[model samples]
Target: MIENIISALFFLAGISLSLYSVFMRYVMGGSQSWATEIFTMMLVWAIFIGFSTALRDDKHVSIDILYDRVGPGMKKVCELVTLIFGIAFSLFFIWTGIDMVSTAYAQEIRTIDAGFPIWINYLIMPIAGVLLFIRFVEKAYRFFLKKEIPTEKEAGSEWQL
Candidate 1:
């Protein structure tokens, strides 16, 4: 619920800001360079947050062609393999996010439009990366160990693609 709220707020705010940018740029016959920068940041943050929510809800896109044909045990194996991949991807994301944030911070970069430290924008990367990691771990745990996410607890029921 909280995740939904945060993502929705970011998404809505980004769209609103973008629309305002368009109105100000075309209708007012002037440019709002800062609008684009700010909206882009908001949109990016919303997207990253959405990724976490999707994983938690088992709503991420999938190709179930191979999974659909597998037997029960094979299905378990497949799920485990996919879980491993998810874990790997999350770790990689976290590592790269951290690297990006650190590099930007060390260089003392700043955003042209917002005038805030550029690192502030990049900071969301590692933070969202951590959130993604936690979401991945939670889904894996619920499916394989705790089985708390209903379909995850039920054998051969998860529809992840």
Candidate 2:
């Protein structure tokens, strides 16, 4: 619940900052490059932060064709397989992204736009990936416990309460 709130706040901050940047761009006749750069940075944070919510709610996109064709038992198996694969993939991303961030930090790289540090942008992929990875683990735990997995709607409602 607290994680959701934090993510929401991060997203709201991103939106607000982006809008302000856009307004400044239009109204000021010659916008500051940092405005756009900072806004872009905030966008990365927003995406990564919001990703956990998406995972928690099962709002991530996937093709349901096979899901529809499979029997109940098969569907469960498929879901388990997919979940395992997802965790592995996310772990790979997390590992690689962390390495990249560390490399960028050591190099002290900066983006061309507004001289923003490169590590900041690269950091999101892993942080978001880790959050998503955690969510996947949570799902797997639920599956093993024989608990009814919450659909996106139910997960969203769980937060409302």
| TM-score for all models, in order of appearance | 0.86, 0.84
Task: Compose the digit string of candidate 2's lDDT tens values, residues 1-161.
Answer: 76667767767787887778777788877676776677677767877778787778777898998789979999889979988998998899799999999999999999887788899889987988898899889989998898977776776786684
Model 1, stretches more than 4 Å misplaced? 146-148, 151-161
Q: What is the C-alpha lDDT of each candidate?
A: 0.82, 0.82
- Write model 1 residue lDDT over 1-161, tens digit each, in one string: 67778989999999999999899988998898988888989888888888887887788999999889989899888878888888888888888888888898899988887777778788777777788888877778877774667543453355445
> Which candidate leads in TM-score?
1
**Model 2: clashing residue pairs?**
none
Q: Each model's RMSD to truth, in Å?
A: 5.5, 2.5
> How far in Å is the alpha carbon of 158 misplaced in model 1?
22
